[model samples]
Target: MEELAINGGPRIRLKELPSRRDIGSEEMKELVDVIWSGNLNRVGGTKVSAFEKEFAMLYGVKHGVASTSGTASIHVALGAINPEPCSEIITGPISDIGSIVPILWQNCIPVFADVDPETYGLDPEDVERKITDRTVAVIAIHLFGQCCDMDPLLKICREHGLYLIEDASQAHLAEYKGRLAGTMGDLGCFSLQQSKQMTCGDGGITITSNDELAERARLFADKAWPRGQAGDRGYLFLAMNYRMTELQGAVALAQLRKVQDIVARRRRVGDTLTKLLSEVEGVNPPKILPGVKHSYWLYPLTIDTGIIKATPEEFARAVSAEGIPASTGYIKRPLYMFSILKDQATYGSSHCPFDCPRYNRRIQYKEGDCPNAEKVLRELITIPVNEFYTDEDVNDIFRAISKVARYYRENPKA
Candidate 1:
């Protein structure tokens, strides 16, 4: 057929790929209410508490604790559970720094576990192997809005008496086998970073049904003070201040109301693009396991380099040349390979956490530790499937991918 777009063929001439974080009159109205209330911090504000209650109820949980950022949410979760200092918390190797920073913050060891190649999630078997006498918790991250297979993970937790937490930072309103994400675990945390489908610039929440954990999370998020209470505040637990502002809460509440529609649009467009790309040789769409409902945060396409004769970076360049925005890899490498963990460089060279004698094991972060994650990252190409993208935008992405794929297959170069 047609000539490849990378070879002087027509490109998707649009100035922008898609406009996301859609704010409107409704959002402004909510902000105005917060502004007039004159309460900036949630410690004495109404919006934060209202949003937390609504969000927790939506996930079928009894309580929610709003925090300053996603990392703060995790830190609060860890603090609430009080996982032993210098103990181990096993987590998937592939994720944002937020996933591991909390583990380090708690003076705990961050045990690296390989991910399931198909879902790019925590592999239960590897997780089981990583557990030890010091293993106190499991942080299962539902990366890119796709839930991890939770049954096995739950089983592992129950068998070991370890706490299981869900890092649903990228997975709002995502369901796994009819049950909503973050509900199956002991506690679930979500990020409201601007780039996420639901955002308030920067904020986070921790949800749990356990009354004790809920109480602790609330206290921890607000510097161990009894929030929603007046007079003679007592510091219950050793904690830090990570409170969300009224402004963030107002906008986040508005965004939360639109999450269902936003998630649906992303899934629809992502599925449609996958449907078209599936027929194209050398292109493999993201894998949605049986009974899994994926809320597409970022659409990942794995290219079979053997057939395409091109690396993920090269293929992404070709596609981008055609005006479709795509990136070769999500992160530079697995979390462990980074300097913070590799050389035990945390805590300003003291390595207090990793160096703690209670953490007796000599941790190392060499290559080949997480082979699956490493391989998947290399072959992965990420495309934004934001809610703002329409069918036309999806079609354009499809054509760009197809053009580059076929061209690379035939030419084996460029």
Candidate 2:
């Protein structure tokens, strides 16, 4: 057996893997048009509106509202939904805080449901159990570019009269049961952050087929001011200014045209890694659900402590030492465990949402709220998956991981 890289042995990979993102003349061309026009704001800019229309058309949606960030996109969705303040919005526990921050900002209670062990998505059963009379909506976050099991979620929401919002920030073109990630809900949110499959530095967009919801989303992103209405400066309701700049719009439009191909390439990399790692003892690749396609925002796996004789952190370290970038526990802990939710640190100790009179019951978040999520975090290992990665890059990753797993298996105590 080959000596372990972590123990002063030669590394499995000698050179750095591909990390460059796809960006080129297409983006530059769009930016040039925007600059030449001298319209940097979406109010009079062509690129942002064009990007929105094209994005909505791509998803077969009627409207797409562009925003400043992924968090802003979710906020736009929430603002459009117009949930009663202090109403509860249930969502998966394992996700970026962007998924939860909007709930607090809207003065709504952010309730977290545990994730499915296999899919790492919102568990419909757990979601149903968490519902209360105050529940107004279910924000189904398609975590890690894989759509949640939406059938049961849609059913539950329908029976309960709850609005379903799809936070598909990481899932650009992910599909579930013949439905795209963002189209399966009342409102769908996406991110254009630099790390996403497609990006415009930092931006977001919300899409919806419902006409009223779409109009509301558009207005909400621009502070509820209807810009197109002739001679109407009518500030409709409480909203925010989360509009996307013309520059971001330009890059986003270019990125949108290339996103489908980008996701396809990323899928190949993720699928290939899953296949190569399938037989590697003690290491389990991501569990892609039936009829679900993962867009591979990040390649996540788990280590079996029983068979590998090493914790996820230790195993990740070993793999990293072999020249493959690896990390344990995507978020270190569940979002609720963070002081923001656990300590109710919102509004300068006001904790308005948690302790507000509008919300009758005292809301609290603590450990063990989502056992499966916590357990999954403990065992999860993540490696970067990029569209630019070549066959050799993937093989090097496999080699490094295989070497680490073999060493841990043989040593029994390493």
Candidate 3:
């Protein structure tokens, strides 16, 4: 075996990984247009509306509401649904807090469901198990560019009479059985955050087929003002100012045009890496079930530590030292394990709503709430796969990972 790079041995390729958010002349041109037009805000601007329309059309949705951030998009989407106050929304435990913050902000309960051990998506059976009459919706977050299995989830939502919202923040243009990730649910939200598969620095959009829901989202996004009305009494409901500026819209529009290329390249690099890793003894690749098309935002994989005889963190550090960008765990812990949620840290001590009488049920978050999610977070490693990587870059990744795994396998006690 080749000497380990971390131990003063010949190393794999030392070239830098691609920069995040590959902006070019296209993005520059869009920015220039935004400045020249001087219509910065979405209130009376054409860029935001145009981007919204085009984005919605991309997913075959009827309407799209642009917002300031991914979290704001979720907030507006939830407000549009206007579920019974203090009701519960079920979601996966392993995802960005952005997926659940809107629930807490809306004064609603976020009940977490365990994820599939292989796919790292919500286990549909577990989601069904967690549902109660108080459950009004399910936010299926497609983590790491793969679409969560939607058929069973959709059936469960339909039977339970709950709205299904697809959190496609990481999954841009991903497909489950040929249907787009965001298109499978009642409402689909995408974040064009800087690190996502697509980006406009920081922005988000919510898409829906329901005209009424779309209108409500639009109203909620812009402070509940009636758009283009005859009378001056425009306030229909108290809502947030989650508007996206035309500049962001312009950049997002350009990004949207390039999304297909980005997603395809990521898939290519990720699949190649997966095949390469599969040849290694203990490394597990991100699972892509037969028909599901993963966009590969970040190539997430789990190590079979039983065979590797190395912890996730150790493996990550060794591989990173070998010049591959890898890390152990996605977030610090499962969403529920966070101090804010576990200790009911909301509204500063009051825990209002959680402690409020209106909800009428005592709520508590526990560490064991989603066991599978907990296990995965502790055992997973994330390797970023950007679109800018060439075939050579992918080959280097394969060599780096293979070398690291071989060293670990041979020195189980080390």
Candidate 4:
């Protein structure tokens, strides 16, 4: 393995993200025109209503309610369910904190569950074990664009009479067993943040098959406004202002129109990278479970730490030095382990809605609460796989990663 010049230079700077305007200019302009008209609320607005209708049709859901963010969507869904305070919501701890934040915000407790080693999604077995009479819901996150094993998860939720909410923030347009990710659960929330496959700068949509749940979500998101009522009339119930703006809805509508092409390009790049990197020693492509159509939000590779001489950080730095964007580390740890959860002063000891003192204290994560999650966090490396990558760019990335892996294998530090 030949060592190239290892100067500190990023192959791709963060600022170089593909422009949303370039991808969906027409829709953006329409959104701007609507914004200029000064009608942004959900009531009696064409852009907002049109976006919701189109989005609902796309997802095959009966209703689609837009929210300020994915977190707010989750909060609205949970509020609509109206789970008892302190009731538990089972979810993976390895996902983005946003997935679990709504649980805490809803005055409910988040019960951490382990993720599958390969899929990096919630493990049904772990979720089953974590359920109790107080468990009111299960928020299944489709991590990194891959859908979880939903068949078993759905069964578990049904058996326990728990509300099933799909956190489809990353798995936009992904599928499992011939069913779309967002449509499989009782309520599904999607993110249109800057990083997601589709973006309206920042926004989210909640979809549901039940009209009652949808109406409840709409009310919770709009400060309990009566259905079909446009003007504010002193409000009807306690709720938060989580409505999406006209501009955001417009941008999102435009982005939605081109989602298929964007997803296809990402898959193409992912396929090329996976094929090229699979041959390199100590580098493993992200596993695709059967029946899953992944969106490739982030292309991840797991390193065999025993064979690789350099640490994940060293490998990432080496690749970045060669002008290929690379990163290491799992997104974040289980939410329970965070200092905010550990420090009672933040939310107060009584802040935890549940009464399981033993479960609350002992259930807190230890160093190896999830052995596979910890292992993946320590050994995984990720490279950008976006629609903007050209054939040459993909090739360059492959070469850089291969060179880095070969260098680590050949050079052993005593």
Best by lDDT: 2
- Pick the winner on lDDT between candidates 3 and 4: 3
Instruction: Give candidate 4 misplaced runs (Cα > 4 Å).
Output: 7-24, 229-234, 348-363
Instruction: Give candidate 1 misplaced runs (Cα > 4 Å).
Output: 228-231
Candidate 4 lDDT, 305-337, residue by residue in tens: 788888888888888777777888767455666
TM-score of each: 0.97, 0.99, 0.98, 0.91
Task: Report the lDDT tens digits of candidate 1 across residue range 159-183.
Answer: 9999999999988888888888888
TM-score of 1: 0.97
Clash statistics: count for each candidate: 0, 0, 0, 2
Candidate 3 per-residue C-alpha lDDT over 98-152 given as tens digits, one digit per residue, 9 for 90 to 100: 9989998888999999999889988999999999879999999999988888999
Which order, best to worst by TM-score?
2, 3, 1, 4
The lDDT of each candidate is 0.87, 0.93, 0.88, 0.80
Lowest lDDT sum, 10 consecutive residues, model 3, at 405-414
**What are the per-residue Cα lDDT tens digits for candidate 2 across 1-414?**
888888889999988888889999999999999999988998888999999999999998899999999999999999999989999999988999999999999999999999998789999999999999999999998988899999999999999999999999999999998889999999999999999989999999999999999889988998889886788689899899999999999999999999999999999999999999998998999999999999989999998878898888889998999999998899989999999999989898587878888788987799999999999988889999899999999999999998999989989655
Q: What local lDDT score does residue 310 receive in model 1, on the 0 to 100 scale?
A: 89
lDDT, residue 123, model 4: 88
Better of 2 and 3 by lDDT: 2
User: Residue 276 of model 2: what lDDT?
Assistant: 99
